[model samples]
Target: MNMPPTATDAIKDNLGEAGSHLKQAASAAGEAIKGAGSAAGDELRLGKANLKAELADSALAGIAAAENMGDAAREQMDVLMDKSRDVLDSASELIRERPLTAFGIAFAAGWLIAKVARSSNK
Candidate 1:
């Protein structure tokens, strides 16, 4: 003849099964949190690297613009010097063509300027 399990024995068996299931659930939860922390750290590292790359690109762009401006300023100075030489050549030609006239005009201008300055001072 077979005997049925007692009520106390059945209850203890159910408690053991419940405890095992709870332990498995707790382990799974811990693994999920660990994986999430690793993923977050990877994202933060990528963001920092991207920011550094962008800053380097911006600095390089600024340097290139400054170099271009410097080149333009040098070109403008060359043009100004060429124009100044042209003006000096014209003045020399005029003076050579009429030396006495140029000298009389210079003296007259100087005298007029002096008279005007002295009167203003008084």
Candidate 2:
């Protein structure tokens, strides 16, 4: 003989199905949250690496600029030294060519310097 389900029995079955659905929904939501956290962590690590690379590149560029400036300064100093040497060499040649005139000019310059120094002291 077939018997019909009672009201209490029907409600029990419906409650069981509802509980199972709720568990599955909770699990799915938890998995979604975990995946989002992992993705956010990955993005942070990638951003950190990119920032380090850019800073290193900028530091290297600054070093290269300083080195270039140093090279230019050295070149300028070399030019200045070369000009000074040329002037001194020309003066030496002129002094050698006219030794008597050179001696007279030196004596006059020394006398003038002595006079100026004495006046300043007074």
Query: Best TM-score goes to which candidate?
Result: 2
Give the per-residue lDDT of model 2 (tens digit) for 3-69: 8999999999999999999999999999999999999999999999999999999999999999899
Cα lDDT, all candidates:
0.96, 0.97
- Relative to the true structure, candidate 1 reaches a TM of 0.52
Q: 76, model 1: CA deviation in Å?
A: 8.0
Cα lDDT for residue 112, candidate 1 = 100
Q: Give RMSD to native, each candidate.
A: 6.2, 7.0
Clashes of 2: 0
TM-score of every candidate: 0.52, 0.53
**lDDT of candidate 2 at residue 66, scale 0 to 100:** 92
Query: Model 1 off-target regions past 4 Å?
Result: 1-3, 72-122
